[model samples]
Target: MEIYRAVVARVRPLTASMIRVTLTGGDLPAFTSTGVGDEYVRLFFPHGPDRHDLSLPVPTESGWETPEGRPTAPMRTYTIRAVRPEPGEIDIDFVVHEHGVAAGWAAAAQPGDPIGLNAPTGLYDPPEDVVRQILVADLTGLPAVARILENTPEHIATRVILEVPDKASEQALPAHPRARVTWTHGGNGHSPSRLAELVTTALPGESDLTGTYLWTAGETTALRSVRKHLRRTLGLDSSRFKVVGYWVPGSDTWTERWEALPATVRAELEALWEAPTDDLEDVTIVYEDRLSNLGL
Candidate 1:
């Protein structure tokens, strides 16, 4: 939960839908990367009408805290696109859109602009014996997918499935001798997503799943369906695959609904959140079911 302050060192647009911002200085000298491909960090920026009043949160033993009367900073999660330890630089690739807190900031970011980031956490972990890897994502998850491909062992064969809004959103990904890529146009907020269907269909037969690892990330609702298929239908173990939700279609509305819940009902959900559990998948399923039951 430590917050490391930094300043924008460079800014470059990688594609029509993606922008890369490089950060350096401040506590970056102490920042450490998990060295995992799908690692990500939370970024905090000034929250105001103009968004020029840069106010960062204070790190605490339990988490981070904002001073009383100070507006909570706008925060967004982003993949660690690349990191150069020697120069203490970190690159975060942001998905550009017409409207979004992070996208707006990244679109106008300039060198020496102050920003705050926390330690990174990663989810992609292929078994040592993994023979084949399947990576699936939309544009929002493209940065992590690209990093995953770059980190894959040369001996392992990889299959990449990407869904982008259009041809303009597509960019050259890292090349691998044994890698194959399949791109599908449409479904990056411009149209209905077919990521789940595409991934499930592109997958090899059940008999071919042995020694295979699957990793996917994209819109929350889409990935939820994919998770169900992989777990219940395919009976894949958590060790064999990783699925993540990058964004939600109407997150602002979701947040408002959450805040409007009765105090007692909210307390019940908070208790569930505090309940200790070792099985993440089971816990997630239960939480989602509870949310649905409560009409959330």
Candidate 2:
């Protein structure tokens, strides 16, 4: 729940669709890293009429909050590409798009621009006995995927399937001794995502998944389909795979509808989340089904 303040120190283009921003500040010296490959943080940005007036959330006993009469800060989650503790600096890679607040900020970021971020949490945990790692992602999740490749153990064979908009968007990734990478062009906001389909074709049979681990992240809707296939259709255990949705299309509209829901309906959704269950996937299925029924 701790927040760290930093200023943009450098900006550079990584590829046609990605940019890297380097941040440094005194507060960054105290920042802690989880040391997990897919670790991420919630980045806070300036908001309101004065774009330079940073609007970071205030940490309270309950949680973070915004001051009364001030617009909530514009925040987004992003992977920590690299951390250089000695210099009190960290690198964040962003996928540039025509219509996202975070993308816009990254595209125009200048040195000395202020920013804030919370401590990181990670999701890329392969079991101790895992012999092979299957990593999947779209452009939005590429940074984390790259980090995972760099952190994978030498004994584990890795299979990477990356979906980028085009060949130009792809970059050279860290080399793994036992890695096989396949790149497919298309489906990164320009068209429908084929992440689930490609992953399905490459996955081992249900009976052969014992010592394997699967990790994937991308658009929310696309990931839901992947989750359904792995959990329900394949009957895969939740502990064997980590599936995360990095972004949702039309999020603004979705938020508006969610906020307008009746209190009782909201409580129902909360109960679904809090209910005890052995498989988290079951909870997600029911929660998302209810949201779809309400056109959320």
Q: Tens digits of per-residue lDDT for model 1 on 84-147?
A: 9979999999888888889889999988888999889999999888999999999988999999
Per-residue lDDT of candidate 2, residues 1-296 (tens digit): 88888999999999989999999984898999998998999999888545578978887786688888877889989999988888889999999888777888889899988888998999888888899989999998899988899988888999999999999999899999999998998887789999888778877345478788999989777777677778877788888899888877778687888989999999999998787788778889778777768876
Model 2 spans with C-alpha error above 4 angstroms: 49-51, 68-70, 204-207, 260-264
Q: For candidate 2, which ten residues in a row score worst on lDDT?
A: 201-210
Candidate 2 collision pairs: none
TM-score of 1: 0.92
